[model samples]
Target: MDCEEARFGLYALLDDELEVSKNLEILSHLEGCPTCHRELELDMRVKSLVQAQLAAPAPSPELWNRIVRRIDQEAEVARRPSGGVAKWWPTAAALRMVWGAPAIVLVLSFSLWILHAGQVPSPFVEELVQEHRGSVTRKRGPVDLPATDPAEIVRHFRAEVPPSSPVPLLAQEGARLVGGSLCHVGEAKGLRFTYEVGLGRIVSLFQMPRPTRALPFWPRLGPRYIAQSQGPGVLVWGDARFLYGLVGELPQEDLQRLASRMKGI
Candidate 1:
């Protein structure tokens, strides 16, 4: 299967709803395509998160009592004969409305939660991670621009890529630049800087325009900075003009250190 075909059936494949033959084809495609594989992984993570949230703890006894009382009232109404209506069975419409309202409310609440979740750092971090994974797996030729000098990369981006902030050049020990490229996540257009840390490990940092409102999360390392793991090691922080997300597979401690040293733009 090609990328488009594989993506089309990704959800079905994840939920094991696809036929065996089609599933096998998509699996084969994912095994060879890092980009598609990353997308599948991301969908799986999101599905699992939603499931966990929906599988909320049992309601309190008082809450259960309230629900049972409501159900009992519905049952009584269903049993009572009204006008020409028989009591043998309730009308499908009434049954659905009475029984489905709670579930409908629950689903709506979950949807709103997902919407808010997509608003800031978590979803944004996932977007950066996908971009980083793409960069890691993309083929590179010898003719590509050199990336050893962080300053040169910064200058290049500033001069050539309009409407971008100065990408931070890590001054930490044993860190080296591994080139950069113009990239976008949703409506935010920016630059992606790849780097090689100890033992050839790769990390990528994405810089984009600062969001109008900041909704930060933990482990709150600073007043304006917050970091969290989402399928990879992700550290998100922002300045007055731009937001940055550093993504990699390095230990969170190591990632935090690298992020902390990201000063002086």
Candidate 2:
């Protein structure tokens, strides 16, 4: 990766959002290329220091009030009764302004918030999870990522993941080691890992190596975020180099802890 992309990756790696391919790329380069590696190390140091000084708690009630008020104002427009001229148009316009405006504002504001949210990068990962609730209900379709023995799963991953490395997968204790597989990433032709959890939960994970097209920092399509429209609560984040995304509804914190456990959280 070049300096500019490497710089964005450094932050993504620090936040643990870098994609696996990117993770391997930056990390591999760091081993052979000293300059980029050193820069990444420095970025991590700064990221930790900044995170440490974060406010102890979320915004206080007073702050929330101000925030909400400002948001409301940005979305608010006086609605007038359309008694004469094109009666339908006025009501339609009012509805459009009411719903459409807030939706647009929220989308834009969220984009700004996510650009720097660190631990959470993609805003719609949650939306993807919400939509995936249906597939679970059906018991069919979606990529058939079945489970297998951990030993066998390891071999499969090693064969598929280029540069072949050991990607950890420690499902709940007592749970069967099912299996794991590499799936086509998104439109980017990248790759991701999917593990069929105990009985129900399925764990899908991957990292962004680099950005190619004019996709959002967080690549997604239509109802699909990271090219996935259905799945449990999928988590996406990055550090200095790679972008990471995990799909599963298993408790948010649990998922985070699981991810942390897989690598060096």
Candidate 3:
């Protein structure tokens, strides 16, 4: 096997999940390959340390009896016939875990990748698109409250960008931060920071490097503009010559008000 494939397999081998034949094949490869031999040695040392630490745990005899009983009970359940159907009913705790929303979401996120499996972008294109989505927490998901006062909002946002980066200074007079996310913009990652102002409306913030925007960028389309979705307004502008698209629910007058607040034009 190739070194890269073998390196990935080494962890599974250490875990003893691969077949004996596959392990022998990997060992043969590792024998001839000095690089792989080094990797295997490292993995062996780490595994031995972990196993030694794990082996230190000693269960009490009473707890061991309970574990044995539980295992036997599970085995009996597996053997029993449930109304002539194959036996496999979950215990009560398992049912609760199965129905939990967070668990459902975790499973769905993994499945969602398969559902959206499309043409994988080339490395060049992959390098261009930005991933701006942030982690979703259990309680509030990803959105966060925006600072109402312009000075505080400026202080907050400035901290996000690096000192050497070309992000514009804060000029959002009346807008409040609603929530924000990082999103992909063509080939580059952009920050999708959203703001809400008067009348329960939203103004989105898009931040991206100006040059790497999609195929049809500036001069042909626009330097900066606003778009709407589901009644919410989005303001797209460029900073340090980068593109930023702000999207949220709101009116036209307020939306432009949100847009013009930045000096980037």
Candidate 4:
């Protein structure tokens, strides 16, 4: 399979939505072509970020049906005429009086508010969970910059990231740095460090410059903030200059301990 073919199937592959044969074909292509493999990882990261931001409790189907029923009832009431002079009718004058400019303005304002409320932004740490699930658990090869040595990874990131960013060195026993990759936590650019923490588990560490705008639902910088379990455990904490996160299938306590041992937090 070529890169274009692989790109078309990347999301399906990540979601396990494709047939087994087609999945194998794309995996084979990815294994052979580093560029396409990296493309797959990028797709994974982007999908993660989007799912995090867009995730919200959708209005139930029953709720929508109820809304439709209520609207129909209101329309029926508006169309009906009263038995006496005091009764209501859908007269042109009455319609104009009911839906005057002020009423129209109120309806428009309410619609806008609903639109804004439905788009509530999610925390960046959720994105980290998805990033780890996709880039580490789902697929493991073809990092942007591959290096086992901490210093070498540091050198690569120094050139790729800003000067203020200091990459952490993993010091936990049995955990070894696999490589590094460029990733996006929402719209902000970030770096991901891949690590193998033994027993078939992987940990992904993400670091990026602090966002200028406050992210909704993110904890203040100080102690580690542990997010609710979402497939993998996520731990997030930030300093004045940068934000950091760790994602793994390991227990939350283990992940937190791993984060604490890192040279830089």
Candidate 5:
């Protein structure tokens, strides 16, 4: 099976809804393809994590009855003739006024449900994933500012970016600073540092000013925070000044270790 087909059936396979023949084909493909196997593993892990974190409470019967009654009342109102103050208002406008509150509630509840289920990723997570994917998958020779010294990269960033921005030097046994580039996270100016880890593994550290809006969900890993964005693992934390996010195709434990090291600096 091709990667696309395997991915298409991944959800069904995980839920044990696939036919035996199709399941065997996907299994065979996964055994031969490390990328597909890793993707499947990550999906399962994320699913478990979400299930553990979120508790879905059943709606109270009273609340359900109230909602049904409200819907019936609105329908009755719509069927009635225009009268009194509502006579001047258009039918569509009247309907909107009656349904706006429930509509908003439903929208927000759906958004939160999807987010908690790990079905729809946040915008910040999406941005980080795109940036990391571009850096890793690009058919390029080297990064923009190729340098081993973190100090030199900081100096370059200070010259190009905001001088007041804090650029912490990140060092670990299996990782070394390669280069960096100026970037942005939302409207905030930021910097992305690339590191070369063991066996050509590339990791990216993105930093920006602490965003005004807090993330809906980011699990704490010691003093830092860790999240999985699609396939890559992301570790994020902040000091008084800046917010930092590390993205790579590393295990959660490995990413947590890296985040701990970065947090110390």
Candidate 6:
């Protein structure tokens, strides 16, 4: 299979929706192509992350009945005799009838199920977790632009990341500044800073502009919000200017201590 075909079948392969023969073909292609393999790996990780975080509730019998009734009504409309504008009514009006209420209810039900599961991790936290894992596991070091001085690193980011969010020099005792990198936290441009504490433990600090709307679901940590149990650990906070997130494998208390230090910076 070519790259395009492999990519097209990737989701089906991950979800086990493909036939045995098709799955084998894609798998073979992925094994031989490093780029396709990485893409598949990233897709699987994202799906796992989303499924782990979001809860899917079983659709109620009444909801199913309602959807069936809506479909039946549309079918009846389609079978009706055509006259004047009524000729176009079956094609256009039936579609609106089928999709309007039933589609909305299905979407709403799914949304409620996700919301009911637990606190939803923000996109920023998701990106931080992925970056943290990548940094720790990769054979090479993490930083793209290396520097000891936080100011110099911030300067580099300002020139690189658009809209220029401030990269705070986190004041945590024993935490040595490693360097920084330009990255994306969700759709917004941001900067990531790596720090080392005792025993060569790594902590990542991510900063981006505050999103237009605040997320109401995330758990609060003092003034900041936290997305825990998603991966490693992440603490998020922000003000009028920028949103800041700290991620690491450190204990919750330890991460909180690090976040608290940043509050004064």
Number of the top-ranking candidate, with lDDT as the measure = 4
The reply for model 2, stretches above 4 Å from the true place, is 1-147, 164-166, 171-175, 189-199, 207-231, 239-241
RMSD of 1: 16.8
Highest-TM-score candidate: 6
- Clashing residue pairs found in predicted model 5: none
Please give, for residues 148-230, the per-residue lDDT of candidate 6 as tens digits.
Answer: 68878877666765634455776899787866776654457667887765444568888777777765564354446666865
Summed over model 4, clashes come to: 0
For residues 120-179, could you state the per-residue lDDT of candidate 1 as single tens digits? 434344354345546533543112334657777777677644534566777678776756
List the candidate 4 regions with Cα displacement exceeding 4 Å.
Answer: 1-143, 214-223
Error of 5 at 78 (Å): 57
Report the C-alpha lDDT of model 2 over 1-265, residue by residue, as the tens digit: 6666676677787678978999888776677778878887788778787889654555554576456655654554334343655444544435546776777788889978755563443455444433432333233323333445656655655554555343545544533343333444444323344543432455666654545334365445421233233335666655434456777756666566666656644
Judging by lDDT, tell me the better candidate of 2 and 6.
6
Error of 6 at 4 (Å): 19
Clashing pairs in 1: none
Q: What is the C-alpha RMSD of each candidate to the true structure, in Å?
A: 16.8, 20.3, 18.0, 16.9, 17.9, 15.9
Count of clashes, each model: 0, 35, 20, 0, 0, 0
| Higher-scoring candidate on lDDT, 2 or 3 | 3
Off by over 4 Å in 3: 1-162, 168-172, 178-187, 211-222, 228-231
What would the TM-score be for candidate 4 when compared with the true structure? Answer: 0.46
Model 2 vs. true fold: TM: 0.34
Query: Where does candidate 3 have its weakest 10-residue lDDT segment?
Result: 124-133
Write the residue-wise lDDT of candidate 3 on 1-265 in tens digits.
8898888888888789899998998888889899989988898998888878653546654576556657877876776776654444665435554666586697789878754552342343212112212322223333333334545544554555554545443257655554454445444544555454433334456676667545354566645555555434566665445666555554666657666776655
In model 1, which regions exceed 4 Å deviation?
Answer: 1-133, 136-146, 160-164, 216-223
TM-score of each predicted structure versus truth = 0.44, 0.34, 0.35, 0.46, 0.43, 0.47
Better of 3 and 6 by lDDT: 6
